[model samples]
Target: MPAFDAAAEFDRQVRTLNALGYPALSGRTEEQFAELVAPLRAEAVAHAGTPDEADAPYDPAATGRVPFVLVVTRALAPIERTMPLTALHGGKLPGFVDRTFEPGSLERFVATEEAEPPGRDGVHLLFDVERGEEFCGVVPNDAMAAVAERGRSLLTIEEGVALMTHAPRILVKNKCFSLGGSRSGDRRVPAIWISRKAPKLGWCWAGNPHTWLGMASAGARRV
Candidate 1:
C-alpha cells in the first residue's frame, strides 16, 4: 500500500490552485503547507481504530464542523494573508474569497450534520482448536467450546455443504460504511480490527483527504 503524505499532497494542491488564476496565496510555501497538513495527518493516525470502527462516517455532532474548517483555513491561511489585494480583487480572482484572521473562520464555511448515533461496544476475541480457557468476554467455556467446534465443523465441510447448512456461520461484518453513508459526501472513515493473535484487518470509508482536497482545490481553480 502507498504511504500517506499530506504535505506533498498539499503542495500539489497549491500548485494547482495557483495555476487556476486564483489569488496568489501569500505564504503558501511548501514548508507552510507541510505545517498545516501535519496536524491533520496526525489526527488521522491517532483516530485509527479497527476496520469496523475507522474514521469513516465522521459524526458531525461528534467532530462538529470546527475541525474541518480549521483544516481548510489553516491550509489556506498563508496564501490568503500574503497574496496582494490586487490579486484578490482583480478580475483574476472571484470576489467571494477574502482573507480573515478570526480563529475558527474556516469552521463556519464547512457544514455538518445535526446528529449522529453512538457506536456499539464489543470485546475482541480469538479461539483456537484446543478451546483453552484463556479467552475473554462473558461467554461461558462450554459455550465457547461449542462455538469453536461449530466453526471447525463448518470449515471442515465442503463449500457446497457449508452453503446449504442452515447453521448460522460466524459472520463479522463491519458497519463503518453504513455509518459513513449517513454523513457528507467527501468525508472518510478508516477502521481496523486487532485480533488477539492474528494480523489486524483494516478498512476505510471515503475520508481520503487528498481526493477531498483535490476536489475543493479544483473549485478554486475555476477563475
Candidate 2:
C-alpha cells in the first residue's frame, strides 16, 4: 500500500487548478501554491479539531462549512477494490456493475454511471473500504447524502447458495469534483471537509459516519 503524501498531493492539486485556469491560481510555483493553500489546509485542520476529537457522532449542522484534513492512503488488500458506498440508506447503493451519472465539476474528480467510455474525462476508480472510520475523519450524514447523490458504487457477488461477494468501492480518481456544503432548513451550511487532490480530487468514507449525530464523527467531541 502507498503512503498518503499530503504535500505532493497538494502540489498536484495546484497543477490541475493551474492547467484549468482556476482564476488567479494559474502559473504559480508549487511552493507558492503550497503557501496559498496552507491557510485553507490549516483551516481544515482547525475545523476537524484534534485528531483524538474527530469523526465521532458525525454532525454537520454544527461544523458549518469548516474544512477538515484527511490522509488518503491506499486501501486494504482483501477489500482493496471494495469502496465504501455512501447513501441515505444502504438500499440506495448500486449493485455490481451498476453505474449512475452525476453532475461534473472542476473542484474534484467525477465518475460516470456507465463503464469506462472511449473519451470521457472521468475515471472509474474504487473507493477505499476503510472509509467513514475515526482514523480517517468524520463524514456527516448530510455529507454522505451529498456523496451518494453524485458518487457511484460497484459490487461483485459470486453466484452461489450463500452468495460470496467481491469488492465494492467508490471511484477516487480521474475526473475532478467537489462537495457542496450541507444544508439545514432553508439556509445553506458549510462545514470543514477534506479531499485527496493528487491521485484524484475525491473524498473517502473512511470516517466513522455513525458518530456524526451531534459531533463530527464517532468519538469526536461536540464543540
Candidate 3:
C-alpha cells in the first residue's frame, strides 16, 4: 500500500463537484484541508522506514515502491444520519456501503475487473448496493485519473452517479485525482462522509454523494 495524498485528492474532488454544479463546501480552505491531511502524511512518512526512498515499502508485485492510502473527510449534510448497526461494534463500515444509497445503487449493474497486487497496478473494490455484493477489479491509477479529468467535462449527472457507484475503482481514482495529485498501487483508501443536513455530522467510510445531494437541495433556501 502506498501513502495516499488526501489533500490533493480532496482538491480534485472539490474541483469535480464544482464542475458538476454541486459545489457546497467553501469554509475549509486548501490550507485547512492540507492541515487535516498533514498528520496522516506524517504518519505515512514516519512509518516509511528507509530514508531517501531506500526503505519505502517495496511492491513485490511492482518493480518499484509507492506510498498509498489517502483518507479524506467531507461534510455531506447539515445533519448526519446514523448507522447504529455498523457503529455499535468497533468495526468500521467498508467503503462499499455508499452503493446502497441512490446514486451508488447504479454501481451494482456494472462489470469490473478483479483485484491485483499493489504498486503501479491499480486495484479497485466495488460494493453493489442493490445486489449486496462486493466486486474487485484491476485498473491503472493513471487511467482512472484520466477518466476523472475527462468526467469533469464529459459526465452527466447520471453518468457521474453511475461511475461513482458501479465503477468505484474508477470513481475513487477520479475522486482521488479530482481531489488532486495521484497514487500508484493497490491500496485501500478510506473516505468519511459528512451529512449536509443542519448540524452536519460525519460517517466513517461513506464515499458517494447522491443521498447527500437530495438533502442539500431540500435544505437550500435558494438565494
Candidate 4:
C-alpha cells in the first residue's frame, strides 16, 4: 500500500495553488507564498518518512491521505473570495456559490461560539482534520456540540474551503461535509458538497439532517 507523502503533498499544494493563481487572489504574490512555505517545505522534507498522526487516523491503509491541510485563511482568502477560485478534483472543475446561498458575502458566515481558528492573517497548517464522515445524518446543531465535547473545533467556512481546495477528492458524491465553524446568525449552516458532479459552496438548515453530509472538524491550526 502507498503511504502518505507529506513532503510531496506540500510541494504539490504549493505548485497547484501557484498554478491556480492563489497568491494573487489572497493579496499575496507567488513569491510570497513560496517564501511562506519555505520553512514548512523544509520541515516536510525532514519529516517525509512519517506523516502526522492526525492525517491518517481514518484508515490510512485505505485512503493514503494526510491528516492536515494547507490553508489560506479567511483573513487572506475569505470563503466567498476563494469560492470562484476554488475547484474540485485537482483543479479540474471550478467551484461556485449556489444561487440559494444568497447570503451576499460568505464572510458573514462567522465561526461558531465554541470554535476558534488561528485567527491571524496568512497561511495555516490545520492538523487532525476529520471530514465528519461519522457525523453523517447528524443534525448540524448536535454535531457541533459533539465536536466541542470531543475537544475538536468544527471547520470554519474558510477551513472547509481550504480542505477541499487542497484535497478535492475528499468532497465526493455522498461524503460531503459541513463547516461547523460558521453560522450566519440564523438556523443555516454552511456546507460543501457535490452538485451535479461538481463541487459547490452552499448552505443547509441547521435543524435538518442528511445521510450524506457530515460535520468536518480539526484538532488544531497554526503557522
Candidate 5:
C-alpha cells in the first residue's frame, strides 16, 4: 500500500487533541512536548514508584542464548510500534506489544529470537527486559499472531522491565494518547479515527473514540 505519512499524521493528531481540549502538540519540539506533559509525567512517576524500588530482580539465563521460548498470551492489540521520527514521516508505522498485556497471573517473560517474520503465525515479538538479554515462553498460537500484525513490530527482548513499564507510564501521564477503540466479541480493536503522533509511546485506538468509548467502556483502558 501507500507509505504512512508521519508528518501529516502528526499534524492531524495535534489538531484532534486541540479539539479535545489538550494543548497543541504537533509543532512542539521534544523538549517542548516534555514540558507540556510534565505534570502527567509526574503523575506517572508517583504511580509507578522509583526505578530501583519498583523493579524485579535481574535474571542471567534469560538472554544468554538465542531463539528463546515464551509462554505467550494475548495482552493488548495495536500497541505502539517503535518507529523513528523519520520513518514515521516517511509513512512506515509498525507494531509493538501493548505493555499493559501481561497475563494477570504472570507479568514476566523473555525472548531470544529477533521476532518472527511479519506475517508468520505465533507471538514472536518481545517485551519486558531483564539484564542484557532474556527469554521466556507462552502457549496459544493466537497470542503470537496478535502481537505480530500488519505493521512494523518493534518488540525489545533484552533490556529492563523499567523501560518496558516506564515508557508507557510516562506517555500516559504526559497525556500522550489515550486508548480509544471498539470491542468486537472479546477482542478490543482500537478506534481508527483518533490520531496518534507518538505511536511508540502509547496505544491509541485506530479510529473514532466516540463510537467505541460511547458504545462500550470496556475497551477504554485495555491498551
Candidate 6:
C-alpha cells in the first residue's frame, strides 16, 4: 500500500461497489450504477494521497488504513437492502441487522450535523478517516463530544457501512465500533460488529460504555 493515484483509486472503489452487487440491490445494473456515481470521480480527483498504514482496531491488510470510502447513499442503496449483502470471512457469509431493530427502526437514526456527508443524496466521498478506536470504553455521548472537540466528525451510518463494505478486515472481534454520528434523538447509537463470527448491524446505549466498541470519525467529505 503506497500513495494512491486518486483517479485510479476512485475507479477501484466503483469496481468494488459493482462487485458487491450494490447495483442489483438498488435495481440497477453495474453500468447504471457506475454512471450514477461518475460525478464522484471528479470529486475524488481533487484528493490525491491516502495513508497506507493502520493501527489496532483497523487491521493490517492489503487495504491497510482506508484513505477514503465512497458511499452510494441510502438514497441509492438503502441500508435495509445493502446490509444483507455485506460479506465476511472471505464471503463465506453475509451481514445482518440484529433482530432487536424492528422494521423502519433504522430510518429513525439521522446523521448529526457534524457528521453529515457533503452529498445530500446519491454518492459521497469521506476522507481522512480516524476509526476512533481510542474512544473504546467511553460512553457514546461522551465520545461524540470528544470527537467534536478534536475537530473530527463522527462517522454516519452510511459511512460506517461503507467502510466495512469495502474493507471487511476492519471489523475485528472485540474491536468493533459504533456510528455515533447517527442518533434517533434518544440513547440508541448504531454500531457494526462481529456476531457469530460475521459482520452485524446493531446498536448500543448512548450512556453505556463498551470496552470493545469505539466511536468512529472522519475529517472531511465530498459530493
lDDT of 3 by residue, 1-223 (tens): 4533434433444344343323233245555544443444434434433454433433312321122223121122111121211121122432223432344332222212211112221111111111001111212233334333433211111222322322233322111211111112223122222222111112112133222211100000000
Q: How close is candidate 6 to the true structure, as a TM-score?
A: 0.87
User: Per-residue lDDT of 1-223 in model 2, one digit per residue for the tens?
Assistant: 2333334433444354344333232244656544544544433334434444343332322222111222111111111121221111123432221122123211122212321211221111121221222212234445445444545221111000001111111112211112222122222121112122111112323233323211121111111
Model 3 per-residue lDDT at 143: 30
Q: Which stretches of candidate 6 lie over 4 Å from their true place?
A: 1-5, 48-64, 89-91
Model 1 CA lDDT for position 218: 5
lDDT of each: 0.23, 0.25, 0.25, 0.73, 0.24, 0.77
How does model 5 fare in lDDT? 0.24
Q: Model 1, residue 12: displacement in angstroms?
A: 8.6
lDDT tens readout by residue for model 5, 21-85: 22322344545543443333223233322344234322212222111111111221112211121
Query: Of the pair 3 and 4, which is ahead by lDDT?
Result: 4
Best by TM-score: 6
- Which is the winner by TM-score between candidate 2 and candidate 5? 2
Candidate 1 worst ten-residue window by lDDT: 214-223
Better of 3 and 6 by lDDT: 6
**Cα error, candidate 4, residue 147 (Å):** 1.1
What range of 10 consecutive residues in model 3 has the weakest lDDT sum?
214-223
Q: How much does candidate 1 score in TM-score? A: 0.21
Q: In candidate 5, which residue ranges exceed 4 Å CA deviation?
A: 1-25, 50-82, 85-135, 141-223
Task: Name model 3 segments beyond 4 Å from true.
Answer: 1-27, 49-65, 74-223
RMSD of 4: 3.3
Question: Model 1, which residues run further than 4 Å from truth?
Answer: 1-26, 48-50, 53-70, 74-223
What is the per-residue lDDT of model 1 for residues 89-134, given as tens digits with 9 covering 90 to 100? Answer: 1124321212222353323322222211111111011111111112
